[model samples]
Target: MILTVISAWRSLLAVAGLSLTVEGLYYLIRYLKRFRERRPPQVLFFPAPVTCVRPLLLSSPGHCNCSRSHRESALSCLTRLLLSARRSLDVCVFTISSVELSSSVLAVHGRGVRVRVITDSDYMALAGSQVGAFRRAGIEVRHDQDANYMHHKFAVIDGLILITGSLNWSAQGIFGNKENVIIIKSTDVVKEFIEEFERLWNEYDPSNYSFSPKS
Candidate 1:
């Protein structure tokens, strides 16, 4: 009888342990789900201002053959700025024909960064335009639908840094022309650009697009 009693107790203990294990696992899974749901979106932070200028003038004396070190070109500066984005990149440009800059944008998008492009509808279909490639990669792109052109050239990185100026984000703008790019880290300036981007983004929404003649 005692042996049977002990056997019964052992069976009960094993079942109890398994029940406890299963219950623990269930709670763990529930907690994980809740944590994931409650987690906030990630954002990259910048404490101080950072500025990058483009088409750095040669530091060599008399702009001569003096082998003095020079700052990065506009293309390199812009590419680096794009690559530095961690959370979001909002590009509001007149056109994008620079292969290198487009590649950098694609790289960031591939890495899970939220990217949005707003460009002139006409230019988007031009030869060598990367807008189609962007759409194929599942990036959201918007364009002005009106007769007037969307001639803005700027980008906001992580809602913190603002990149703007005469740079067109094209090979011609970066290398061929006397272009300038100013990267500003001031939040006030960034805020203005962000507002403009949001306004244009909403205005250019496909749903709101109208090619009909305006009264």
Candidate 2:
């Protein structure tokens, strides 16, 4: 008796413990499967509305604008993001003279990234000497003469990350000026910019330029 009852109670506890362990594992697997299925797949197209909308909703409070310190932090984040990119870099800049920024862009080009730069003709002419270094490093530069100001400042990386703001690629713009830059993770905005750039690319013939080393 008493010994037999104790043995049976011990056996029952062991069976219950084994059953709970199995059930816990099953539930864990089910939760993991559900989490994986609910996750959104990666987007390869420009202007992915889902990413754009999510960021827009999140940024509505400040509209992606930050203070000077925050801007620097954002720029640092943007730089790291660009460095992680492996495919292509497209920039439409109104002003670009910072050696550090230029060096960063060159580093990406050296890693076999295709770089296309579009800027005002006058700015290109002013930076004619430096543009050759970029071309020699395998980056293509395009001068836009259509816009009255060519005031756009945006860089699209790998068709996913778009960095746009009042921050020019100038030393002053990066350090001195009160610039606010947005690191937009939107494919749709990038695609729209790419198409717009292609229209300008088709219009502007590179042959007429006597400034670039490629010319």
Global lDDT of each candidate: 0.78, 0.65
User: Which stretches in model 1 have alpha-carbon errors above 4 Å?
Assistant: 1-71, 212-215
- Clashing pairs in model 1? none
User: For residues 174-210, what per-residue lDDT tens digits would candidate 2 score against the true structure?
Assistant: 6566666766654556678778767765665586554
Candidate 1: tens digits of C-alpha lDDT, residues 1-215 = 99999999999999999999999999999999867654543222221122222222212223334343344444555666788889999999999987768888888898899999999988888998999999999999999986688999999999988888776777666656766566776566689999999999998899887677667
Give candidate 2 regions above 4 Å deviation. Answer: 1-72, 127-129, 207-215
Best by lDDT: 1
TM-score, candidate number 1: 0.65
Choose the strongest candidate by TM-score: 1
Question: How accurate locally is residue 109 in candidate 1, as Cα lDDT from 0 to 100?
Answer: 94
Model 1 worst lDDT run, 10 consecutive residues? 43-52
Overall local distance difference test of candidate 1: 0.78
Error of 1 at 54 (Å): 18
